[model samples]
Target: MKIGIIGATGNAGSAIYKVAQQRGLDVTAIVRNAAKAREVLGADANVIEKNAFALTAGDLTKFDYVVNAFATPTAYQHIDLAAKLVRELRENKTTKIIFIIGASSLLKPDGTKLLDSLLQDENAANWIATPIEQAKELTFLKLIDNVEWLAVSPQANFVPGPAAEYQLGVDHLLFNAAGHSIVSTGTMAEALVDQIENPTVPVRTRFTVGDK
Candidate 1:
């Protein structure tokens, strides 16, 4: 499969990039810095450096799936980037899109939210995370009626780990018997690949990753 990963140099993205190659899937690392991504993600795949939001239909002819792990350092840029990508994806119909969304949009037990969980504290790690953009992206993506897309929302706590045997859920929280929220990056990547191969989140649908 020809997969294009945006922001393919970050932690989650880099992990996906590595696994894609290990699976022998043809992949492209889309980012601004070819040198840095080649250093972090290493070489052996196609490197497409440029913005996807502004990419014309002619430039969108290479890949079959686009996983957007890209995020701007600032809040405004984050929203803009996501919004533009959604618009472009709606316009450009050449590739299937699998967005690497944040878990901030996940709801908590008390009916609050994971995104606002750290809203009170300015120093919380999730605060600076990219959920805000994910929320906006979700809103924009929901409006498009005829697009093949998958928005995979991770568990509450996602860290580097091997793909533990787990269950997959749709549009809801996935919790363990102990009620701890978690999802391995490896398993999440696996699920993302599945959606890419067989889309279930296309056009106003969602999928979740966590233990059941």
Candidate 2:
């Protein structure tokens, strides 16, 4: 399958791009700096250098799947990019879009959204905007009914590590046998590619993954 990854230089996106290549899939890195992409992905990597928001409909529709791993310090762009992509692909279901949203949108065991608890942290103000906007991104995505989209959230503590056994859950925060809510980038990438290859989750909904 043909796949394109935006923000392919980031931790999660790089992991996804590398995993896709290891599987021998036709993968392209949609990045801003072609040289950096080559440096990170490889000299042989196929790349399309352009700002993600500047990407045209014609550019995106060429791939069977596009993973939006674009992260920004400007948190509001999280929702903005989602809206732009949805607008570009409205009523066209051929190319599926997958969003790697923040874990703040997941649900706790008490049925409350995880963002609430995150907000209660004393130091949350230091880096709360991204999670807030990501929750908004998911909320906005849920309102759209026409686009073929899937959202995936990592566990409460997402770290840079290698792939491992993982368990998936729908809308709820999942914990492993040791009661830790965490997932490595590689594990998330593995789950995401599995979904792209064999889509089991219904479109327009969201799912989450945690280390097992």
Candidate 3:
């Protein structure tokens, strides 16, 4: 399958790029700068570096699937960018879009979200804003329907590490006895590839990575 990972040079994007290649899929990575894209991601994978804001309907049509794991520098602006992507898909009739949302959107057992928990302290508000930005983009996507969208939440404590054992859950969360939710980038990448081939259509729900 031919796939395009929008924001394919970032940490999460780079992880996906490597996994896709190992799986033998035809992949194209769209990044913001060509030179950096080649340097950071290497020159083996197909890559196109262009300002995301400058992407058009034609740009979106170049792939069979597009996973938007990119995040804007700010939250409010991120929503506008996400809207553009949704609009771009509609205009081009491109049907599949997988958005890399934040873990803040997921609900804790107490009914509060990860974002709400983090916002309780002054020292953490600024830190939490990053995830809140993801929430904003997801809120805007709620109004879109032209594409099949999948939103994924990394474990509550997303960190850099090798792929570990995990589970998958939809619309809620998966937590271990230690009350921590975590999954390696490698595990998340595996679940994503599953969705790419046998996409859960009309499944605009959010999924999480946990101990499988």
Best by TM-score: 2
TM-score (C-alpha, index-matched) for candidate 3: 0.91
Residue 134 accuracy (lDDT) in model 2: 96
Cα displacement (angstroms), candidate 1, residue 148, comes to 2.4
**TM-scores of all models?**
0.84, 0.98, 0.91
RMSD of each: 2.7, 0.7, 1.9
- Could you tally the backbone clashes for each prediction? 0, 0, 6
Model 2 poorest 10 in a row by lDDT: 64-73
Clashing pairs in 3: 166-210, 166-211, 166-212, 167-210, 167-211, 167-212
The C-alpha lDDT values of all candidates are 0.73, 0.94, 0.76
Q: lDDT value for candidate 3?
A: 0.76
Candidate 3, residues 85-105, lDDT tens digits: the string is 777877445557788887888
lDDT by residue (tens digit), candidate 1, 24-51:
8998898888988889877655798886
Off by over 4 Å in 1: 52-54, 91-94, 120-129
Write one digit per residue (lDDT tens) for candidate 2, span 1-212.
99999999999999999999999999999999999999999999999999999988899999999999989659999999999999998998899999999899999999999999989999999999999999999999999999899999999999999999999999899998899899999999999999998888889999998999
> What is the lDDT, from 0 to 100, of the residue 100 in candidate 3?
81
